[model samples]
Target: MTPAQHNTPAFHDLFATHPRLTGLALAPDGTRLIASGQTSDADGTGYVPGLWEVDRAGDDGIRPVTGSGPGDFAPAFAADGTLMFLSGRDPGERGGTGDVALWALPERGAARRIAHHPSGIATFAVAAGADTVAYTAALLPGATDAESHGRLRRARKDAKVDAVLYEAGPVRAGGDGEPHTFVRHADGAPMDIGGQGLAGNGDTALSPDGSLAAYTRAPTDQAPDTNCVVVADAVTGAERHVFSRAGNQYYHPVFTADGSALVCQRQREETHDTEWRVTLVAFDLASGAETDLLPGFDNWPWPGRPLPSPLPGDGTLWFTGDEQGHCPVFRRDADGTITRLTALGAYGSLCVTPDATTLYALRGAVDGPPRVVRLDVAAPDQEPVFLTAAGGLEPLPGTLTEVRTEAEDGCPLRAWLALPEGASAERPAPLVVVPHGGPQGSWSDWPWLWNPWPFTARGYAVLLPDPALSSGYGQRMQRRGLGGFGEVPYRDVMALTDAALGRADLDAARTAMAGWSFGGYLAARTATLTDRFRAIVSHGGMWNLEAFQMDTDMSAYFRKLFGDPRTQRERYEADSPHLDAAKVTTPVLIVHGGEDHRVPTGQALGFHNDLRRLGVPVRFLYFPDEGHDIGVPNHIRVLYETMLNFLDHHVLGQEWRRPPLL
Candidate 1:
């Protein structure tokens, strides 16, 4: 296919239907590679992820391994050449609509269901040299076997209890159920390993020899606010104490190659002033020794990137860390030494060959979208070998360039500028400035959720600027917005936006702004502070700081940023956007996920209500099924559609209309 076939002046279907590749899995022998990706469903209402076998050299076109009707993932090869994966193919799950079960596909036969659990399996691992499998399942308290678990569940349903007694755990609005890791040999009896795993979790790992499993146990009544990393013997179900520090949280436990150590990330608040930086940690099994990997290493694991990008093999661990505007690969040897292997761009969704000779990852930068690449172990920083054609992606709809500016305080700032074709001094394109989230995050890499390609296709220029709170800039830049999210970052954003507007091809009069999370908060704050832009959109932003402090998951974390509402009321009033909602004159679009606990739905609902009460032009979009990030494909489609429609109506002076979401 050609770029012309996919790109057009009108709404491009490519944006909605393009194949998205993620989660790569390498076979034990290094000869076969399997990948999992989501494609547009038949009804075009959602996405279904399926497994595909990728040719090592990309000679043969990628072939689909299993049908897309049922979502499949985590494809692992067993020692007996049996491939096992988790899927939601069966409708007879334990009352959960989309609960997953283990399915096996032999070397030369069709796939069939291999195992089933009452509360459904969350994650699983196949033994490398042994014929055992380990997975996590939610069993009823005081119930051992699946049958007893089911009986107790039935009794609980029959009684119809509404209140739950207090046992210390994460406070959320739902039933309090715990997931426990279970081990079993393939086609044999399963044994329950007593450790409280997170519901719908993914931080469990099984050793290569199938003798040990490492998992993160959520804090219980005894330890109210601390996560415990427990390593248990698979066959005996004997738990041992590794290393844990007070006031520290551990997660993403993976067994070392020799099965004598566990590698994971440690998050702690060393002080009350600064944000936590997750560092690599190792816990030895034999001596119960704790080793801090990359001691004093400034960089952290790629923020907001799901799944640890590196895999450990052959007594070595390899992973990605964010450093100086790039998320590169780092290798850790057994002797407590670390080396940087790759540079210059962000890397994620990584896997390594069985022999550990080559590394594979989906890499991208501000100029391009993610594409699969292969790198040699010896010299990973060398030019990458593109493994796939990336579904023959179309040519860039616009030109991408970089912009540099300095804040009033003399802090240097960087931004990425996307200008549509035919933009010139005589005909400047309308601009949309997008600030990143985390306030601690940067726009150093390409973003799938906030892709600028669509804006460029519509003859608009998108400016992604990183302000004082951005990473990769150094500690001084990070500390600039520590307790004052509304002050320093605001100045930094205005500086960069003013610089971008100075360009001959950008139209400041017709500009708009949009963002999600902290980005969304900044957009709302910007709208309240100035009337330069025509419109504003805030997706899942915190509008009321005092109210948000109570509803969010990390209440303590938010408290650390902005002090207690009673003690530091002035700061709350100074930083919050909703407290000054009456000053917001710009037309606004407020979008939020109803199930979001991070920046609760009330944040958007309250803001929209206030804007309406103040006689301001505003609209609200809510997705009940989505969480912090909108994951459902159908909701994502509507989100992209509504955002464009809102921008077109206000910024481009088109007729005001609403999308089909009543």
Candidate 2:
């Protein structure tokens, strides 16, 4: 008997059939590890997520734990070793209520729904050492119990009322009815830990003893809606503000081992001259004093739910942070000394064993998909031991190399250049410049959606440039691109691109550029500024800066970055890509998700309209059901197909044949 072999060069099938690994958790006993895996349905139009169990000792292969899936995700283990997760499976299919509910899977029996709510559970957290769970769900203003909330939900549904009424400006959407946090013991009725209204997209945490619960909420009194963290008594529902500043955001609270302090991330407000910075801070529960945990550490720390040290009540913490092109684990001891752990590949879903001797994380690089890896906590410099296989990936069809250049102001710019196989001086591969989103994010790890393999496999060279606003390069790089999107970031991108093109294996004359979100904005902006690229593609990109400043999901954050668009017209006029639509001569393919509120679909529509009226060769690919990022499996196919087709015609000098599915 033998296993089956899979074929390669299946670009469409790659996305259609590949199983994606996300979100990881370790059982209390530390013998089992669980990860959420999603695979495309038969038709590849949607994805069904399930839970998979991985052997901690790497002896047995990975196995599935949940078969009847209605999208099980956010795997976590209760202290009693019960596997807990959230699911939306239909009642008939899996005894689920068809609403997102908290389910528990005991080690000896089948999984069962433990907590049901009229409104689905948005997010949840379990105490590290107690049978306590805290979760958030939506309930109408006057509704108390599940019955009352169900009535209210029915009333709204009967009236077909899906609109969100905003009594103020900077309106946003999504995240269910109205959110509130609750806590519960094993098989006990949940208690509402009363506090200010929870933010639609904020996180919640439970103290190790389950005595305190922390959550975040947006300020109702102000326009720039930044979150403020609040601590509530799990039993009394009495709430107290932990951290709240007018222009800052405090979120993702994690309780210290002794439960006397809370460590959380703070997103500092940005001005026209400075970009936002995210760092960790600890709040002393006794005095309500805020202490900057890593004041001298400039890198952005990817804080996981902190794991206790080998000693029970030690205040030592473990987390990951980005440096250069890799994300490494870092340890902050109880004495405030910081030490860097492993020094390769990016990491996520980090967890530690109960004994605190070994640490586990999903490690991936630009050249490889993520795999489960374990490291000895005491040996910080030792290489990680692999526990699960890396996504069954073959050798990359291309070669990955680093490119470096100096920006106009002498700041160092770096990028990852992936050259297709057989690219050489005599036959240089055509180039496609891809700038990452976030402007605050880095292109350090393997990205499933915006992956470069498909393009490289098709004989195209992909350039991933980390420009001025990219992370891992420290504050100076971020501060250089603060005032507007058009100036330093754009120059940094061009600088890196030029350095890549100078190589003998990349064709400079035959090139194109594409991006998403902030990168999308850069692509659109670059199309207007340069005619070097034969084609341009912008997905979920922003065009009109003024309109974008007012309509995005985090409009207040942008408002604080750049002042009122009405009053501060200089920044809008200088940076808005829509303002120079008439200058775009390159053929353009505009892709946008109709439901995208982050960059918004309007940016695409307006850009397309202007280009069409000006007789610029333009095509618009719109997905009405998608959001800021395209998640639908089939839509993902159409996106790549259309993009490749457009590039083939404009950059590769091939005939334009639109994808049949589109």
The numbered model that scores best in TM-score is 2
| Local accuracy by lDDT, each model | 0.74, 0.80
Query: TM-score of model 2 relative to the true fold?
Result: 0.95
* The best candidate in terms of lDDT: 2
Runs of candidate 2 with Cα error greater than 4 angstroms are 1-8, 66-70, 90-92, 95-97, 168-170, 195-198, 221-225, 303-310
RMSD of 1: 3.9
User: What lDDT does model 1 reach?
Assistant: 0.74
RMSD of each: 3.9, 3.5
lDDT of 2 by residue, 268-364 (tens): 7567876768788889889999988888888878434445453457777887777777788888887888888878788877888877788888888
Residue-level lDDT for 625 in candidate 1: 78
Model 1 stretches with alpha carbons more than 4 Å out: 1-12, 66-69, 91-98, 155-166, 173-176, 197-200, 220-225, 269-272, 303-315, 333-339, 444-446, 660-662
